[model samples]
Target: MTIRFAAVSACALLTLAACNRTQEPVAPASAAATPPVESPAIPAADPNALTAEGLGPVRIGMTRADLVKLWGEDSQPNAVGGPDPETCDEFHPAKAPADVMVMIQNGVLTRITLTRGATIKTDRGFGVGDSAMAIKQAYGGAIVAQPHKYQDAPAEDLFAWPHGGATTYVTDPAARGVRYEIGGDGKVMKVHAGDPSIQQVEGCL
Candidate 1:
């Protein structure tokens, strides 16, 4: 009887242990979360003005001394290419575009030229590498289309006065204006803007 009681007590203990183990709750797994990053904003670039009046800060009537002030007088200006030695040589300034060339005659800024690689443009937004046909299409019938002095296929040298006057860039009291020199490819090779001095087919002889 004592042995049977001991066996019954052991069975009761085992059943209680099993019940306790099954009743215990399981813990959930934890995860780490990451946040998103924001990007910085960019500023807008300043617009440059090119017209018959001038090219950017260089005006048609500005004095040679004034140019020195703007372009830096680290080196003296060379003699202009035309008949007059007074004009400065077509040299590029560090501040100006790579293709830009400033011309001064009688100590006054007479012309500003734009060749390949220049980003600045006329108020009309015209610049080098533009098509001759594109220019005609944009300006309409007001432009004067001239034949290139050298090229045979495409009529290269094209002249226009978007400001509504037969302006001159030659000599004398040079008038305010601009001119476009296109190449055989029908694309503009040069964009000249300034006083009448800019009209010269070639720089001072």
Candidate 2:
């Protein structure tokens, strides 16, 4: 009788231990009831008449009249033999050299020439032979091109200065860099520092 009682007590204790071991743990109330966090609000940018960078405002497809309104008159036309009547051409006045060359056709702006000493700012990626409208689409305004001479292999080379009286397009005057050159033939000739001077044709009709 004593052995049976001891065995029954041992069996009861083992069952209790097994029950405790298999019980599920309770999660903290705080952790289970937590809410999601919200993000902070960002501030809006300031508006100004001039650009944030302090440069003047720029627009694309601006007409000759519109250009005159924005930049005033050109200092002087760069085209030799004075301005051409067949083509509308004007230079920004000395006070506002940024205007550069404004070319027009049938009273509509056709092309623009950026001289080496202008202040007009542009973002369009303009190259030589690009019409005024095309140039404005890529770059808003004209830029200066420094004085540079090309050295081609044959005297009859396309870029030979006098061949067509090359029109130098200054892409970044501040950097003293020229983007392209338009020959008299109205074709763009590559004029960079490389052998066989005329590298490739890059321009717009």
Candidate 3:
């Protein structure tokens, strides 16, 4: 894949609540790829405001019943290749305005991904189509940029979450709770929320 495409996927995947242990994630290095020139203009988002903690009534630690009660029965309540397939339940919230996906692990919600032109934005006010530079400026140095696994660019991963404790001291990969996926063209394309599980790329293999 192109370096920018790889970065795009990583950022998008991470935001979709796919992540690793607390240690800063390292994107796989590209042996023969160049940096993306500029991010292209992506679709506008759904404008459903959300929090770093979650979107609307859904919170990170909520349960299946809670979701069912709030959203009724999910049309697809299972993601076969999810981090914990046996325990993971995926959903596409019917009443939501955006293209939303939620995953529950071990009976508690773990991730929420917005795609297909969902205009959801965090309480911080970042959303799809925003420039990486704009996001970096808005967060003001809190982001931990990671190399794209297959890209030659400097930062394919812009991360935000809580860390720095003996228990969480860089080992709880999920601590970097949110990711804003920037495409080769440099604009945000996807937004993800949840814990370390959000770091996942291709699903549990």
Q: Where does model 3 exceed 4 Å of error?
A: 1-48, 76-84, 150-155, 162-176, 203-205
Per-residue lDDT for 43-93 in model 1, tens only? 443347678887557677888778777775424346334565565455565
Model 3, range 1-205, lDDT digits (tens) per residue?
Answer: 6999999998988886755536677998868977789888886643356555677777777787787787766655563536565576566766655577777778777778776587777767887878889888887767767655555553375677744212222346335367777777777767777777666653333
Candidate 3 positional error at 67, Å: 1.1
On lDDT, the candidate that comes out on top is 1
TM-scores, all models, native as reference: 0.66, 0.37, 0.64
Q: Please, what are the lDDT tens digits per residue for candidate 2 over residues 6-35?
A: 999999999999888966788766646667
TM-score of 3: 0.64
Q: After superposition, how far is residue 56 of candidate 1 from its true place, in Å?
A: 2.1
RMSD in Å for all candidates: 10.9, 13.8, 34.0
The list of candidate 1 runs beyond 4 A from truth reads 1-47, 74-84, 162-164, 167-174
Best by TM-score: 1
Looking at candidate 1, the ten consecutive residues that score lowest on lDDT are 162-171
User: Least lDDT summed over 10 consecutive residues: which range in candidate 2?
Assistant: 196-205
